[model samples]
Target: MSSARNSYDVVVVGGGHNGLVAAAYLAGAGLSTLVLERLARPGGADLVSPLPGAVVTDLGLDLPRGSRNPACGDLASDLVRAVGPTLLQPLPLERDVRAQVDPDTWRDFVSTPLGVTLEARYADDAERGRVAAEALTGTFASLHDESLAANRGLLYRLLGGTASTRGVAELLTQAAAGAGAELVTSAGVSSIRGGDDGAEVSWHDGMSQHTVGARFVLSNVAPWVLQILMGGDEDPATKPEGAQLRIDLHLDRLPRLRSGADPEAAFAAGIVVGSGYAELASAYDEAAAGRMPSVLPGRLQGRGDTLTYLGTHTPARLFADDPQGAKDLAVARALATIDTQLAEPIADRVVHLEARTPQDIEHDLAMPGGHRFHGDLEWPWAPNRARLDTPAQQWGVQTDVGSVLVCGSGSRRGGGISGLGGHSAAHAVLASR
Candidate 1:
């Protein structure tokens, strides 16, 4: 057993984005706070850093197209307060993502069998297929979360929408340090013991075992990780399954689109590929059954001028039905799929290409099952569950354990790259004081 050291007002476990955010706020409020990170850095999984040997400066990419979290405003506001107005800029309200599919096929899918008349603005088959899929799978409803639902007026005022600086963790760490918070990297917590009075955290810093006491303990790890630390049951239901494949492609130049639209304009918009709604649903079902999808659905976006990243959740061809192999193959397959949708050969535009498998994501980001949302996303309004106001249990920050809080993506308001989970956890700790 490690001996307890001097007590602090708060001791945060994990130095990811959420943990750093909480540390900054807690220290700002004059609380003596200390942040312990397992990794050498503090960004957690949300940070988008440049790949080695890559020349591009900006590495942080936007969330998948069509993904909107209501907590975006809150996170942006907090970040602006921590950094400065100049470090952040407003994101556009315009659609950042665009689906690329055969328009004629889409038109036919939506219209009569003879394809007599058009019903939508889409080219042809793609729109009809999407509409049909949406109708069958309730994809629209599934995409929107009721709990973290966005308020249009408030969202409009959030710096007119914003973009994060290159390195989000670095910014937050600097802000927290400025606020007098102590950040100890390469420190892994062994276990934590807390009660109604306070919390004690035991960790190893590679040199020796050290124990610290605090009025409150905030965890920035996945819930399952936390459960293991506290000797609790690791429920299988909470485990998240990630189907998305994250890819980074350094292209010589943007590929010519089949639509014949301006390259700049097309690059600015997001890219989506799939047969339609039915294909997406089927791919999802296959992935859910521990198999790769036959269709290989994907989303593509151009980051900066040189780097174009394409991510696909569905794999058209799996090597032996293995998820890992499928993820490994996704980048090449995604490029090939995009090639079919483009007027030019995309494979030839490649400069440097890198791929991150779901397993890589799980290990690199330290996310369980590689879920960006931390655990399975809970409906904002879970039926029959007591919904607490913001900054409480219902918000997914506060825990049943006394003064033990969660400040990561697993938190209720957490998902995507929004820092709301950390901000909410910090506010809750502050309120208690």
Candidate 2:
């Protein structure tokens, strides 16, 4: 085979959801666009399982988990226009399903006055979290981190919030391809060169190396990868971090909750375990130091054949257990954690169990340290230091490279599967043109 050379109006690197979204917009705008994917297929952390009986699994979580799909602040309107509303299915959480400890057990845990005050604050803030999630409006960029800092508690609600199903990823792939965008998979980009006139991307297509010339290049890789490819000044000092355990399990049926709530009802809601701010802080500290917390901390949500727990990982991933043993232990631990809040062992109904730790995440998704956000998310209020001072940077999608832009999780709006970065980058490029 011969090396290939292609030129496009825009070249997108990384076929993650953001890249696909950007391609769709750019191609729809009548720009000859091409997307290069290092993976066999697109969707990044949206991993479709190969297990015979396994349902689709995601290495990272998508966002805005609400009943209605809002169009503001999230570029949701643009996404709908590009890919159609059918791409997303709203996950309407009917009620909160966080676990509550017995009065006696709770008393033992919160014997101190400080603990009692912290518990009260946590309870009050949980309601605030829910309200903020419900009241999410406008693009996150418009709100700005500084504005939201007035109520610091809303940050997690926004970060943890999202609304969509796996179909969104598939639809984005189809939509981008349908919009006359050329998608090249298994093409690992080696370097990027950008000038005033245009940008050039070089990559190896497994068999041979190839070069792509484009007027503009959109990167969907992590910030560090971007810095390396672009070969610009100072590399980011912030260490990449991720604290998530993605588990895919097939249950015979929803497990009964100890609270006498219907399992389906509980499953439909965002179930919280280990309530209170103290627990959250402790869990973060433990996970930060590479140790599994005494009590698994996070929220649980599931639909149909899939369930995902956020903010929890296996000891094996933390402590360096054998890969297989680690996964098994993690799955076992997850089930045990779930059992703590349920009437019976949810583990009993498990027909199939699969777990992905930070290690699996790093390997499978090529995420540095398996960080879902790509890197540390800076406050929107932080002084503007990027190459461009436009709203794209506020939205967290701007880059130091003039011709190269970002549309990955590392963008300003915070991570998760929301394609705001894609929408932001595409719009910026179109505006510049």
Best lDDT among the predictions, by candidate number: 2
lDDT at residue 413 of model 1 (Cα atoms): 47
Per-prediction TM-score to the true structure, in the order listed: 0.69, 0.72
| lDDT digits (tens) for residues 1-433 of candidate 2 | 1123378888999988878778887888889988888888887876321110100112122323333222113412222232222112111111210123244422322222222323444466444333332222111111112333212222322333343345556767877887888888888898999975688999887788888788889989888778788875544354464556777768787777788886676776647665334444455466557666656654566866566665443322374556666556556656676777888887777788777777778788777667766765533222333333553443446666667888776765435336656766777787777
Q: Model 1, range 1-433, lDDT digits (tens) per residue?
A: 2323478999989988778777887888899999988777778864332111110112222222212222222332432232222211211111110022234532332122211222333375575443333222111111112322112112222322222224667767877888888988888898988886798898898889888899999888888888877777667666665544667777777778898977666565555566464555565567556566666666566655554443434322233257565665566556676676689887788888777665677777667766555655432222343545434554457677866888776775444335656666777787677
Model 2, residue 324: C-alpha shift (Å)? 5.4
Give Cα distance to truth, residue 32, candidate 1, Å.
1.2
lDDT score, candidate 1, position 302: 60
lDDT of 2 at 151: 27
Whole-model Cα lDDT of every candidate shown, in order: 0.57, 0.57
